[model samples]
Target: MKLRFGTGAILLLAGLMLSQPVLTQAQRQRPPEYREIMQAGRMEDPLAKIKAFEEIKQKYPNSVMMNSIDYLLVSAKIETKNSIDEVVKLQKDILAKSTGPGLITDYLTVNDQILRHKKADSFNKQKLVETIKKNAATGKKNANDAKILDSVPQQYRKRYLALSSTFDIQLATAYILAKNSVQAGRYLATFAKEGGTKDGEYFFRLGQVAELNGQKQKAFNNFFRAAGLEYKGADTKAKALYKKLHGNIKGFKEMLEKKLTELPFEPKHFTPKTKWQEKTALVELFTGSECPPCIGADLGFDGLMETFSNKYLIVLEYHLPIPRPDPMMNPATKRRADYYGAQSTPTTLFDGVNKLGGGGGKGNAESKYNEYAAEVERIIEKAPQVKLNVTAKLANDVVTATWSANKKLPNTEYHFVLVQKQEKYSGGNGLKLHKMVVRDFTTLDTPMKKTVLFNLSQSEKAAEKYLHDFEDQRGFKFDTIHNKIDRAHLKVVFFTQNKNTKEVLNAVICDVKK
Candidate 1:
């Protein structure tokens, strides 16, 4: 009877141990460690924070604190050059655990960051909007819960009303993500009537809505109103845009007339030298083959290329791999897209100085493109402070590039870009497409001597050696590999910079096919 009682006691103890919730490493570890790492993250030492969070995650995968730690882990991963998909997957994992409000807010913030990183589509944007609305509405309905309602900001009352009235605006922006300008326009009109205010932001949003809807007159009017507002940033942007639009109509018409007669072979010859010229019109088009609206602009770009030939237009298409499969996407492009704070697809940047939504049709696009082109032409007319020359050569799997500039500028950041031209391939559209896509970009340090050479010969050789050794040793090949050799078309693009001011001095694109 004594032995049996002892055995029963042991069994009971085991059962209790099994029934109790498992503690994660984060739970087992000192809480001070987590606090320290979080503080480090606030200090911008993300790598340190990542190490701390990783230790917590590895030790305590089942702790209640794991949810918050996971969110931090995602942020740390993002800081350390990990893919947004990886960060998002972790967020989803934490969300599955039914975390609390703080964790939920962290999840939402991370989701927004990931969307900014990867360029969310219309469907994704709509899903996010719906989720936000649902959360907000649920929070509002549960106002009796002081704890929940107290967590919400007092400013949210006004924001909620604004959101309610401008729900269609959010939806329209989502449509812009979907590349459905027609729906976007309809929604924008609704938002303008219901939510439009005299605030600069309101007019700016209206202007964007009108621009996307292809209502140039309305866009101009809204922009004009926004420019007249007393706000600083919005007013400045509005004024610049207003002047650009005011001048471009006449300039584009003249260019069109000249093109009709001459059929210019290059952009340099066709571009006129005018005092209004700003700088190299750096047109960065964030697009994807899977997006329908992008297809229209893509066609328009093709036409522009044909008409302008090789003229002064330096267009770089950054294919954002989102919402659909895009094997051609480089991680660098996604990083730059995130850095530029792009929220949706079909976005364009002119001279890296101006950003425009890509919802406009042929007429609107032509006007805007021409306006930008005329500005570029005017800038080039004045002898540039720096003259850029680029040379590109590929040997085996290595690409080497050299950039030479004539004059140095203050407060600039230089970037070297590799571009490749390939034969057009299509998916069911029956139209072939030629693209000048960004292959890679290297951001340089402050103004060095005018000449810079980036040689990847050793790196290429090392990669080849590794691959050959792997095949010989294990008879296995990695599924992912990048060999920059054997590409039929290649180009080099150079940009001068003012590092202190973070401004681009000038940008030049050179065709290596010549």
Candidate 2:
């Protein structure tokens, strides 16, 4: 990300990197004396930048930079992954001196990063969680008061409200990351009790906590509840546990499914929109047919597609090699999984940024679907700064594609892919239909051209490979299974993403010629 720019270019770039419209006028101004130090502070290497800052501190103890040096020092320490205890002390010092309660969010963000460190256990988890609660409370109060809310700028106001809404979940997760599962459970329970989180994912988490605490009955109850809630991984694990504890619950799973279905699944709010790709959303589904935990993804994604077809949502279900093999599973699936850090079945990504769906069970399937739907609805409304002009055509076995932009794109990379609208693969779990299946990938450096060999028709080798994926997972419900690829069911999915940030800019589903 480093570029060698001249003096004028560097000055222009600095404006894009640092801004403080929310701060007071005086705080926003950079003193002339700190110019060289500021430039050195912007070095790419954290340790080298820290050395530059330290040099400034030693050279001018009485300088004006003294006032702001602490913040810079702390930022550097975090950038260098300094000791958690020392960083905690420095961050707390910054918080104590912070005149604005909302600024506590900066410290919380640093602490959250520190908490992510595997060996970072120096700070008290309880104390840190409490501080987040206090900040969240203050943020709520400030956001609710007309005068106080008006005093803050719009961007900071939005940030404060967002942090307030998310602090509890972040704090609970931070505790778990710090290896303080006991405190993590306590905070998560308190969060749920306070009506802070309602996603069925919380129930799966509670089950995990119960298991960690050796509360078998409580754990089983939570896991069992999660199974019917529209989470495949949780349901899979719950079913396994249920069978082990009380062999063949007969109609137990069926009864749970029936009851869940009987419940009214009404979304509180959703407005159907016509326009989709001003900002398109991608659902990267990590699943395998052999993995029973992926059933929820199958059902839930079906619901999503029903709600928003190729118009607003583009689905890519990657079959993985886990627990057992899936014939359609390929190296690309594993590569993408590794890139996304997906280690378990039923993991999904929204726009390659927000991750959702995993674990053994879902506490509420209908509710989870609504949550996902709401996100898509929100994305569908966003107006994009750049629009993608992408097209794909298939001829023989080779596919050619072109991607261009109306204007300069906002940090984007071009990706061309092949997708199947439907494929039939009945593995151990006996799934009959797999949709939005990603078949192949090709990368493009610009909005120019890229081509990849596409499998227009299924080969016997493909069927043989498919059979090999499930040779050991014996007794699939179907006595005879056919593995074939249908070209008529295929299309090309194109993606434009922030090359550095990994954010999807736009996605298109283009029909392929028969």
Off by over 4 Å in 2: 1-277, 359-363, 397-402, 408-411, 450-483
lDDT of 2 by residue, 280-335 (tens): 67778888877865755565676777777675788898887665667676545666
Lowest-sum lDDT 10-residue window in model 1: 1-10
For all candidates, the clash counts are 18, 8
Clashes of 2: 8
| Model 1 lDDT tens row, 175-264 | 555556677677657755774323443455567767777676677666655444322344445445555667644454353334223311
Q: Which segments of model 1 are wrong by more than 4 Å? A: 1-279, 309-311, 360-385, 427-431, 449-486, 498-503
TM accuracy, model 2: 0.45
True lDDT of residue 119, candidate 2: 46
Quantify all predictions' global Cα lDDT against the true fold: 0.51, 0.60
RMSD of 2: 15.3
Best by lDDT: 2
lDDT value, candidate 2, whole model = 0.60
